[model samples]
Target: MSAVQTQPGGGETRYRIAVDTGGTFTDVVVGSSTGDMAVGKALTTYDRVFTGFEGAVRRAAQSVGWDGDEVLRNADVIVYGTTHATNAVLTGRVAKTALLVTDGFADTLLLREGGRRDAFDSKAAYPPPYIPRQLTFEITERLSAEGEVLTPLDEEQVRSVLRTFPDHGIEAIAVACLWSIINDVHESRIAELIEEVLPGVPYTLSNDANPTIREYRRASAASIDASLKPLMADHLGKLRGDLLQFGFDGDLLVVTSEGAVLDVVDVLDRPVLLLNSGPSMAPLVGAAAAPERETVVVCDMGGTTYDVSLVEKGVVRHTREAWLGEPFVGHLTGLSSVAVTSIGAGGGSIAWIDAGGLLRVGPQSARSTPGPAAYGLGGEEPTVTDACVVLGYLDAQGFEGGFTLDHDAAVKAIETRIAKPLGMDVLVAAQAILDVSGHQMATATRQAALEHGVDPRGALIVAGGGAGAMVAAIIGNILEADTVLIPATAGVLAAYGAHRAPIATEFLSPLHNDTRNFDSASAASAVKELGKKAKFFAARFETVNPDAQFSYFVDARYPGQAWDLRVYLDGAPDATGDAARQIEDAFHAEHDRRNGTHDPASRVEIITWGVRVEIPRHELLSDEVTVTGESVVHRHDPIVFGGESHVTPRYRGVTLSPGQHIAGPAIIDQPTTTIVIPPEWDADLDDRSNIYLNRKEA
Candidate 1:
């Protein structure tokens, strides 16, 4: 159930709610017609996600002086984002699935494109496939690369192989045949047979799930979706039931990695779309929080991982291929999505001395149950939060949800686990941890900006997540960014982004044509087909948003190139030479911008054509903070900064009004998070209650 509270007015109130279930926390945002938003946060309960979901909603309701039940009863729209799919794949908690491939390519998933980051390092261990070799079953089907049926599918052999599903105890099945994307006749037939043999078991076909060119990537997407079918179906079913029982009867939508929201019914079939959905929302929040900035880097530092994404010219960057665990080493999903990079650096990331005698912070986290040593929840390992406590960056009594930090436990954990091994005092070890963690985050931020063709010098960095603001200014300063924008809801900013994110769906069609000899008729036909699909998807949202906006993009590259850069199309493709020329010109411009060279004389090849439809969410104007109050320091605490202990001024966020200025060697404590402004930096609150931090020298 939701939090219990009573409000005075019982009039008709329209509500908008968004919930983000993360690895460490479940965040909620309740928005009203009055442009007011209340945020709630609770530790994630892995056993039953709805327990934490309801608790978070209740927390938000309590903050707004409204009964949680009332808010749910009146909500018009509810958007949800989660890290469950990603976690399932990473932790191997997915259903036991079988991979059915064409006869000769049973090792397709094993080969994995034969690409590696360290090409010469033969000693590096090769990673295993998502599905093991023992579980792969081959189908006697043959189709040429040009989609010609070379041999008919063997019906008797298919029945024999599928009949073993019960003995193998397969919960789901994935069908990926050769040349399926070009013509899915054989794959479709196999799917029909699967349903006949296994009535209740779910199966996914490669062409239906991801219609990309590559075989391995397409198979990976299909396998992932098939694996998550049972898990996500159950998870979403319980969530839907809980919300309905709480009196909510509105439209329920789930956010996708592409940063778009889709209906529950539309996404339940292909749950892979929800992978990385939580991190994708950070960029949207950055764009909305910094409307005036042309570019912003959104960094989400949670308890388990730090996810970074770029927003350039107010548009979130899109990627054709996204890896779930690690790029070039992990499984790649060929579906188009918002590009995000994650590193194992967060508040609960453990700090320990490596065998090489170097201090390291995590790819492993304590998560929420044991949390940090500072939580006094039976965790013994020293984490970043413990280091912060030992260094006095985190207050013992200022934690969110009225939780208290165990200072003595934090110090002891740091001393025994890190300081003693490193041959340094606890304070010095904590400072070193902070410095090392800061460098890791800054390095990631720099790489994200560079890969996206954005310069960090003038780009704004929006600090989000619980540990985001604490180290945001430091990371931005290292990159020499223009400024750092920390929203008041920094801890729950992903939920805030989902609260205002648009309803969107993308449709993709493959094309392999050189621009010089482009088949305009064929291209026009393909674009028209994609448009039909887009329209059908948009119709599902008509009840909530009457008008939906549509956009188009084409992936193009110079002939013989391994990868292509996406260029926005002016509109739908046309059966004219001029339209092809326009697309070629756009390719040249993008190539020049990204590679510093343009090949106008070279033939441009278009690989994939895409159509995206988005129905914009209702814009909520932020309430102006007009409580004229001076910035007063609550107290002075000895905090380690720049390797030295200095008395730092601490102020509560609630007492700071718009236009109030504070110079660093200071800290601003919000209920959910803390902002540390280092020396030579100054901070000011804007009308929207966003903290803008700038270097005094700049």
Candidate 2:
């Protein structure tokens, strides 16, 4: 396809566009300078990703009476978030990789930190490592923890080992020598030999990708990054080439797991940093949708997974210990990122009977291909969408994007897989599925909140994703939160968040120092070095926004502790008495808030220091639109609840005014999503078009 040219419009109108590619759908959102917003969605096409991306954007542009190419030509910035890296790692579609470790530590990747979720289950088998042990080669190099060389590098041995790569079909390589973070001389030399012998093969060094203290984690990060080199480099290169071909003259940015956007060149170097890129934006969108609420829980129930995150008092929760596939049981990125807890219980999650004849809602999903029996895509198994269809909660004819849902096929799948085996009617079985899935999500949400020491009861829960609005009320009621806020653009909320995300980059350095006699000169030098690196990275965003800001943080803990608490340090890391005192107070405050206790007399040790640089994001201001009349209900339908049917009034969401109120047992239908307010609940619309659901009082 070629770019379609149209008549030139005024050059003063600029647009901000963002596209988020999830496992099941690709959502596109556009924000015009005139305070107008539009969204478009299409099923995810894994084969040719840009096809779905362009299709979604074209649909959105058409709604605003503009050609897709014209919209790109008039855009100021375009940001994108995708699950490509995550999917590649999960499906084992990455390149054949080789690992080079110190002579005796070849099993570092195989023997991960040597822990499991269950300590007593010795019979349980270990999950496969990112790379097998047979693919690992030993290097004759070593360095002490204090950065002193223990054994000189064997240059001939390095050459000999790399010469065999062609026979082994190693497309990528990872180098992880002992104490490489302190002294990377040996690793650097090996890299030079690889470039000479294996000219085109891409490789990753642990010191460059992740300069942390842990050996296993750093090696894991390097392995994952190296394995993704060929896959991500090609994908991102093609995406950029396609965008330029389609007349997008503005800068193209990729969102990172840090809740900010980075240039494609920066992301290509370390694709592991984008593991949780898409889901990381949901919390930011939740905070922006309801700026009035300080604490908010974002529940995004997408087609494949239910992701939950938190923002306390406007600060998005960030963690350095984020795992990719499974927490503790899966591969760790070893990079700092926004903390999100995910469960495999979304609209497309499959429902099936176990060997013992027990009904179970998924940890398995149908994804987009043959998604759900209702999609008429030749799926024989029942999904959560089928349950919604059987219970009359969803209108098959009025489905999202004008796509028809096959109700008969949904009934057949449910009856065949779930109902008959459970000895129940179709409707009853569907409700049971909904109940089980909802409870699972609710429990996971509550645990995510409570584990962070935040009480979700008084917090506002913002719901997003395609199926987010459908279960917002029930999940909120289950958590007993004050209210739940569902944005009008719930279908593409992640893309909206990407649109508003700032251009940011982060730098981390290891600084092992004691707080009592902190070396002011050493700390100041480290800060200066980190600042220089951060400034260099932030230069990429200067074209979009010139004013860049930087913040400093220190990971500290009492002496003899295994873990450290991250404390925000104001200003630069000088050795002044005031700076030291401020850090001590901040550490104590954070410790108290997190663990409910603090010891001021204990000597603190600084483990690592970091710097964050960002260009302030554009504020998402709410526009006031005048409503001329009272809202009217256009239709009514009977919905089954609690084994009984109730006639529910259905209203178009766009026709509702700011002060409008809809009682329980009602449905609010929008173009892309539907909100179901069950019995004993009421819905209120705020001025910003945000819906709030609360329980009714007797």
TM-score of each: 0.95, 0.95
Error of 1 at 479 (Å): 2.6
Per-residue CA lDDT of candidate 2, range 381-411, in tens? 8999899888887878877642689999999
Off by over 4 Å in 2: 1-9, 119-126, 292-294, 619-622, 625-632
> Which residue pairs overlap in candidate 1's backbone?
3-58
**Model 1 alpha-carbon drift over 4 Å, by segment:** 1-10, 120-126, 620-623, 626-632
Q: Per-residue CA lDDT of candidate 1, range 459-530, in tens?
A: 888898989999888788788875788987898878888887888887878766668898887788888899
Which consecutive 10 residues in model 2 have the weakest lDDT in total?
1-10
Best by lDDT: 1
- How much is 148 displaced in model 1, in angstroms? 2.4
